[model samples]
Target: MIKEANTTFPIHPLIKSRWSPRVFADTPVSDEAIYTLFEAARWAASSMNEQPWRFIYAKRESDAYKIILKHLAEFNQQWVKNAPVIILTAYKEKFNSGKENFHALHDLGLAMGNLSLQAQSMGLAVHHMAGLDWKKLQEIFNVQEGFHITTAVAVGYYGGDPSVLPEDLEESERAPRKRLPLNTLACEGKWIEQ
Candidate 1:
């Protein structure tokens, strides 16, 4: 079963099960699920419909897996390498609007959000890492200079074994974290001071 079935997102019940964990079993991910996840991300909203997000991934048994794994921060590398897939999420700098803006990063974020939710629906876990080594990933994937990586996503079946994950990560994997109160995160009514 997935965690926090009642997610804040408007996603369906199945998708809400998706959660992130550093430790994943060596089990492989099916090609069908990978295709479907990207397909869902393809339909995510983008600035001016630019759809700037792009994904590059390596399956667990592939040689590219090692290269991608090396790009992860030491903290993440400790466990993410055990997963079945290592994915680099990126975005093209240029948009359909003929402008070079930072909106692509935001667009990429939305795409990842869609992917995470979709993976959960399929009984999968996607551990995303923003603290990875961007410079190494760019070189490892042979990405062009203009385009840049946004995050690294580790996808696989959750293996709740405490031995595989660091003590801190293991604690998180065991239970759901609390969210900030709506009153703290959400703003209400007029912007003017009372």
Candidate 2:
């Protein structure tokens, strides 16, 4: 289940080991470990130190857990059942100055990146998904207008059989990870085609 990245150049082992998995063991994650992951996110760099990122999480046994799960798209709901922890990431829409925080989503992504790496370091798996009912999330979590639900995360230990996943996901779970080459992704004052 360890799908180490096949990086062309040397990269940190923790980065290489991080991936989104659909299959998760049903074992419960420790509360302390969850706090550690969020703690790492709490320190991520943000625009003007706005730190707009916020998280709402629920352990499998909590009532809020089902409320969070109900917001997921059916495809995610299927495999997400195996995860012991569910979390939703949200970001503030504007700064206290009444100015729009254009970088809110970007900063939230940075926080999630930090959290994901921290989870990987702790031998835990994190699967982030954009497939969910935003409206339902707002209603269930009582999210205010200024706060937007960004992504849902499933977290747990890695120990589920690929066969248990849906056909397409099963294949995807076993397939090699792919990413565009740096030349195609970065450029010196000009964009380049892959």
Off by over 4 Å in 1: 5-16, 191-194
Residue 34 in model 2: shift from native, Å? Answer: 0.7
Clash count (model 1, backbone only)? 2
Off by over 4 Å in 2: none
lDDT of 2 by residue, 1-194 (tens): 87889898999999998888888876779999999999999999999999999999999999888988887999889888878999999999899898999999999999999999999888899999999997788887799889999889999987778899889989999998889786788889987865
Q: In lDDT terms, which candidate is top?
A: 2
RMSD of each: 2.8, 1.3
Worst 10 residues of 2 by lDDT: 19-28
